[model samples]
Target: MSNTSEAIDNDTVIKEFIDLFAQQDATTLAPYLDQDIVFENYGSPVVKGRENVVSLWAEVFSTMERVEFTTLNQAVNGDIVIAEQIHGLALPGRPFAPIKNMAVYRMRDGRIVEWRDYTNSEYARTLM
Candidate 1:
């Protein structure tokens, strides 16, 4: 636990983290990450460390003209949170259909310690 005084419910932390992603602002997202955070995308290598994770988001954001995530459902169990969402993305010249995404988050001291995203590779490939 980094700061007990600032600790919030793990569910809230995960919800807010997902909300912040819609804004596509990595700087705003940084405070919600633990220093040693780990982020794993569906088909990519694991990203370790807060800075590395944030940088990855920044890169993704830069390539998108618009990004939105609509939560279909969310569930919480202790410090673990699971969110099911439809991710809407728009690139410069292509319209990205909403893609189903499932993310699991682990919280510690109001910050995200780990995040793993699962997506349909076949559906995702069609968007490219």
Candidate 2:
């Protein structure tokens, strides 16, 4: 089925993207994201535009005392890579974001066009 195959492709992209992100390989990530990528961080303001999306992660994430991106589960539907990832941080953690949070990756044409972060503020404050 064309739809099924498309979903599989997007799923692979998501997995590969996550792996690259875990390694903080911006060069690799660059090709996969559009020039106008959009991202939203939980408990923080949204990051619009491609440059900000990439640079924000490069700068802010590098400050984490400790962090992890563990894929707990995933599902693919057409151009959507429905995934639940475990993201945790130890340094510069947001006061309203838990050490661990859930992230969603939305892909289009083998590139990540948009992403959203979700987390619990109460749990995040405990870390702070």
Candidate 3:
């Protein structure tokens, strides 16, 4: 890939990463996740393993009324990717929760191996 093409590919990966969270498509998501992957949300346990990650989302996606994301920026270098985003979740009759967060992903072999999410209390209510 040319320099610019590679950069675009990285950008696409970052965008797709957010899309995966919104879609909660575990089958499609598993291949891009590493075996020892670590995933976190504000209130959930630190999720590990590709299958575990898939399983967690599988269970969570079942109850979703709607999930949406608006990414603010992605900063990527080598195997590190950081994306800042605003997201909202609507759960049936409940009011939508607005969340502001930064997602940190460690990529290895072009797949996410470790991930962390950072946000403050009220700003993290969507993760509930």
Candidate 4:
């Protein structure tokens, strides 16, 4: 495959990955992740492996009434995709609010191998 095609494919995969999160379908997300995918979230221990990440998200989905992300800005460079987003969550008996955050995703072979998230932990604490 040409380099241009590979880059396009990588971007598509990353977009699909983000869509999966918006859909809150952890099961469907598994196929888009590398077997040894590493995921890091602000104020949380680094989660290793695709299966483990799926399990963790499943648990979170079970607890939250709803979770959604709106991409404010996104860019792709080589194998990396960076996004600034508004993440919103609705909890039982609590008003939903959007939190600003950023995520960097590294794609390999059309699958995300590494995902790192950045946000204001102190502000997030107040929201939770």
- Candidate 3: tens digits of C-alpha lDDT, residues 1-128: 35455556666776886787677566878878889999887566888899998898787667667777778988876667788987766777777777788888887766888888887866465355
The lDDT per prediction is 0.83, 0.71, 0.76, 0.85
Pairs clashing in candidate 2? 96-121, 97-124, 98-124
Better of 1 and 3 by TM-score: 1
Q: Please give, for residues 1-128, the per-residue lDDT of candidate 2 as tens digits.
A: 99998888888877777776556545656777877778877778888777777777787557765555667888877877767776655575453233555666777777878888787776766766
> How do the residues 61-127 of candidate 4 rate in per-residue lDDT, one tens digit apiece?
8777878877888888778889898888777778886888999999888889999999998887688
Regions of model 4 farther than 4 Å from truth? none
**Model 3 segments beyond 4 Å from truth?**
1-8, 126-128
Which pairs of residues collide in model 1?
Answer: none
Q: What is the TM-score of each candidate against the true structure?
A: 0.88, 0.80, 0.81, 0.91
What's the TM for model 1?
0.88
Clashing pairs in 4: none
Between prediction 2 and prediction 3, which has the larger lDDT?
Answer: 3
Count backbone overlaps in model 3: 0
RMSD of 3: 2.8
- Model number with the top TM-score: 4
Query: Worst lDDT window (10 residues) for model 1?
Result: 1-10
Per candidate, the number of residue pairs that clash is 0, 3, 0, 0
